[model samples]
Target: MAAIKPKHQRLVLALIALAAILAAGALATWALRNQASYFYVPSEIVANPPDLDRAVRLGGMVEMGSIEMEADGVTIRFVVGDGTARVPVRFKGLAPSLFVEGSGVVAEGKLAKDGTFIADNLLARHDENYVPRELQDMTEHQKDAVISETVGAK
Candidate 1:
């Protein structure tokens, strides 16, 4: 082999290492394909059966008048619907301030053998305006009181 200069040797070694790293990353990306969770609406879930015992995310509006408060205040149960179907869910924790009836929500959980989506986490989707749906129907006096109380804390 011809005598190689130190600088050229180092450059060639670095290039080889970089190429190896890139190939490793591409292989890893391909191997990890399908690791992402699939999200489905209530309608899609109801229409087809998914592989049992897999993680998924369901997003929709909490159905109106479907919230059922258990004997223990912490364990709240409710139903979420995406206009075509409904999914009942159970959550046991302090819900977000935005969690309310008839609001958009995304729940993360696994489907149980009985077909219910057992939520491990609950995230309420609130609009820029944080007013509760119930507050909109309240009289102006009630709305003003709520606003005052909300503002007083800040």
Candidate 2:
């Protein structure tokens, strides 16, 4: 084989480098395909349900009077609802501290064959101005005691 010219050698090297980068990107995307979580609301879930086997994120308000705890204590069932639709969800784990009825939540899990969302994780959504009930309902003397306990009496 004849020797490659300097100009052609640079072009070949550049092409190989470009090909390597493209291959790396494709490989990364393929590897992360299962890790990518798609978010959907209750209305969308009702309109077009996701595959039962794939992981997904369902976000909406926790329907009031729908939360129920099973005998196992950890398994809880609740309905997530947008204004128009609702999806029943079952989760077997500890819920977030702020998770409560009529509050916004995002559950990450798979859709079960029985049309229930089986959540592996739950995230509660709180407003920016949220305050704990203890703090919000505190009397003046209780607030002063807490402040003094926290900052050692200004």
lDDT of each residue in 38-151, candidate 2, tens digit only? 778877887888888878999877887999999999999999876678899999999999798866789999988888999999999753334477875676466434433432
- The numbered model that scores best in TM-score is 2
Number of colliding residue pairs in each model: 0, 0
Estimate, for each residue in 4-44, the C-alpha lDDT of model 1 and write its tens digit: 68778999999999999999998888656643336766777
> Any runs in candidate 1 off by more than 4 Å, and if so which?
1-37, 127-154
Q: What is the C-alpha local distance difference test score of candidate 1?
A: 0.73
Q: TM-score per candidate, in order? A: 0.60, 0.61
TM-score of 1: 0.60
Cα RMSD for candidates in order: 9.3, 10.7
Model 1 CA lDDT for position 47: 82
In order, what lDDT does every prediction score?
0.73, 0.80
